[model samples]
Target: MHYDVFNGDADGILALLQLRLAEPKETALITGVKRDISLVKQVDVGQATSVTVLDVSMEKNTGALSELLANDIPVFYVDHHRTGDIPESPLLTSLVNTSPDVCTSLLVNDYLKGKHHLWAIAAAYGDNLKKVAARHCVLNGVGSQLSTQLEALGTYVNYNGYGRTTDDLHYHPADLYQKLLAYEHPENLFSNKSSLFYDLESAYEQDMNMAQTAEVLFDNNICKVVCLDDAPWSRRVSGVFGNELANQSPDKAHGVLTRNLDHSYTVSVRAPLNNKQGADEVCIRFPTGGGRAGAAGINALPEEQIETFISVLQNYYD
Candidate 1:
């Protein structure tokens, strides 16, 4: 059995899509909500002959990766996140790059020699590599109108990956992947008025409106913090909202904190878009927090520590 493990977000899903489209394969797909990065541990090595991991941080899955190698199950790992000391094992074929501008799908595209270049652009857009995606579109002679469509499609796919669990999402990542497989070109997915794109666009607009109304907890020249009350929409839109905030205020870091059912918070932190540094460093200081330097998150930040989080952000960016 071949197990395919990936992050549920657009970058991960599209990375796998490019590979499967290039070389059709049968594999048991393993994925969860976007925040669920420890997916490698779920693979039963005893029942797996080979595994392909995508977009998930190597640092988070190092133990499980080591175990898979120990069991002699060959693993192909690819990602664009913090990877601490990749293990030396013949069973492991790893392609890990932490460059802020590159995403896993782009890496896979390079590996596949751009056979699925359009899909790669979509993934780049989804991962918020706007300039990179634009360059690809321009080089391919994709007009601005088509570029907008691709960007919207990518953003919708990425937005669907947020949420506390699959139930909170518009479509489970697996189902979305299968639906997307029907269309070879992403523009085909948006051909109909009643398409998935329309559905996701509507939902995204609604959730983002609600998120925008979140109370500002703190705002300074260097940093801003906003708090959202516990709700399905809040949880679903937190990460995307943080991105929007960062883009809107490129010089200032932004933090979006969504209150969890347990009164703690799920925090999304974006470093200043101009600098794109220290977000992971600040987030890692808290328990259940880890991500790339440009953008990071804290899964369950205590309510009491919210002040400290704000302080850290201000100090770091100051």
Candidate 2:
């Protein structure tokens, strides 16, 4: 059977959604929390069929991907994250762009020739491509009211993807994908009051409320760092909270750290909204860290390095 591997975040889910909506497929789905990007290895290579991988970094999955190519299994890979060095093989079809302005969903939208751009716009908003999503909305003649709805929907879907594990998430990414598959377009889900949007909106609001009380570890002219204690809510909100902070203070780089059980931390970093670059550079310096220019994260950071993280961010932004 075919395998569909993707990041659980909004960009990955929506990218595959758009592709399947355009060309229906029956495949085994493999995904996990947003930070769980090394997914290509999960595919049952013995099953023997084509594979479609989305959103997750090519660099992290390079080994598994290389094996797939060696097996002569055709693979369609699309993403906007850092891809170290692409392997050479005619069996691989890769559309990897590291541009901060784009996300996997937007790439799929381009591939589909805008057949399902509304979903793409929402995905863009969820991926924090505010300007790009807004431009797409305007181009489609979507008014302010609809644009706001799309943005909220996108953000909520994205928020549901974060968590230390699926137990902390409202819906497993696979379930969430199935729920969204019912809608041919986002507008349908928006009009249906019973859609997952309402549940996610309420949960997102509660999580953000708790995040508001999280202690600020550091603040300065060029950077701000906040740390949340070990809790399910902290794990769920850390990434989105950083996005909100970046929007609130466009000139300051932001970091949100959620203390893990071992006292290590899961970190999310956002470059200044006014200057959407270098976040990946800052995060890549740490172990278990990698992402795009505008946004990046570290899966686990030793507690002792917290000060170093703050200093690196400050020095980079300063």
Candidate 3:
């Protein structure tokens, strides 16, 4: 059996889409809410012959990856996140780039020699690499109108990946991928009125409005922190809100903290857009935290330590 393990966000989903579209495959898909990065451990190596991992940090899955290699389950890993030390194993085919400007979809685009460049551009847009996606659009002679459409589609798709669980999402990432696989071109998806685009757009608008009015927990020259109440909307919109905040203030880091049912916080941290570093370092300081340099997250940050988190972020960015 072949297993397809990937992050649930647009970048991860589209990365796998490009590959499967290029070469059709029969595989069991493994994924979860966007923050679920330790997916490799879910794969049963005894029942798997090969695995393709995408858009997830290798650092978080090193142990499981090593076990997969030990069991001789060949693994193909591609991502744009912090990867500590890639293991030296013939069973592993790894392609990782921590460049702030590149995303997994773009990496897959290069791997596939740009056979699916349009989808790659959309994924880049969804991942908030707007400039990078625009360059690709211009290079391909894609007009501004179509570029804007792609950006919206990518953003909506990426937004659906947020949430503490699949229930909070309009479509499970696996189901979303299957629905998207039928369309060879992204334009077809936009033209289809029945596509999940409409649903995601509606939900995104409602959630984003709520997030916009969330209370500002902390604000300073170096960092700003916003807190949202414990609700489905908060879980759904926190990641995108963090991205929006970072974009709005390119020089200042932003943290979007959503209250969890247990009173802990689900934190989404974005380093200053102008200087996309230290986010991963700061996040990894917590137990349930890990991500790339530009954007990292902590799944369940203690409420009491919220102040400590702010101090660390302030100190690092200051």
Candidate 4:
């Protein structure tokens, strides 16, 4: 038996689709929303001959990953997340590529020789790699209209992963993927299915609501910081707030912090649209975070350091 594990976001799903299409196989898929990164621990390794992990990082789930590898199950990982000690065994075939220039979807597209360029474009949009996505679309001969539609679907599904819990999403990402699978092209998706557009629009509205209600913990000429309490809505809203705020204040950076159920905080930090190079510096203070010049995040931060976290933001402004 084979099990395919991936992140439940647009990039992860698209990457898996590219792989499955390349090598059609009977396999069980393991995934959940963006927050459910620790899903590997729950899988019964003994039952599978191989595991293909996409989007999710092996470093983050080292214990479970080690367990799977120890059971003699071959593991194939494809991601652009941070890396740790990757086991050196013939049983493991890993393609862990972590770089600021590309996303997991694009990586897989390159791995598969660009046969599924449209799906790769969608994945790039979902990850906010607009320039890269546009360049690829142009090269692939995708017209402007189709490109925009694909971008919208990618953005919508990416936005749906924000809320702190599943309830905040207008539609669970898995269901959204099912809807996307129904159409062969983005034109058919938007033209033939009013329901898909409506659902995406509804999700966008709720995402805006969360953004509007975000508590202003810090406000300055160059930056704004907001904190959200743990809730399905907040989780789903976290990344969306950063994306929306960046658009709203092109000259100012936007930072969103979400409290997890365990009293920790997961931060989504974006540099000013005009100066996206500072995002990496902003996340450097956190032990478990790093990213490119324009965007970064700390996957988890202890609650007790809330004060310190705020202080770090102040440093960015100063």
Candidate 4 — which residues are off by over 4 angstroms?
195-197, 229-231, 247-253, 259-265, 271-304, 314-318
In the predicted model 2, the residue pairs found to clash are none
Q: Write the per-residue lDDT of candidate 1 for residues 54-152, one digit (tens) a residue.
A: 999999999999999999999999999999879999989988888888899999999999888888898888877788899999988888988998888
In candidate 4, what are the lDDT values of residues 119-186, reduced to their tens digit?
A: 88988887777777899988999899888977876777777765555566666766665566554555
**In model 1, where is the ten-residue run with the lowest total lDDT?**
181-190
- On residues 1-318, what C-alpha lDDT tens digit does candidate 2 reach at each position? 999998898998899899999999898999999999989999878895999999999989999999988888999999999899999999989998888899999999999999999889999999999999999998889899889998998898889889999999999999999889989988888888887898899999999999999899999889999999888888888888999999999999999999888889999999998999999999999988899999999999999999999999999989
lDDT of all predictions: 0.90, 0.92, 0.92, 0.76
lDDT of model 4 at residue 102? 75
Better-scoring candidate (lDDT), 1 or 3: 3
Backbone clash count for every predicted candidate, in the order shown: 0, 0, 0, 10
Q: Which consecutive 10 residues in model 4 have the weakest lDDT in total?
A: 177-186
Q: Which is the winner by TM-score between candidate 1 and candidate 4?
A: 1
lDDT of 3: 0.92
lDDT of 3 by residue, 128-192 (tens): 88889999999999998899988988898899999888999889999999999998999987787
- 1 against 2, candidate with superior lDDT: 2
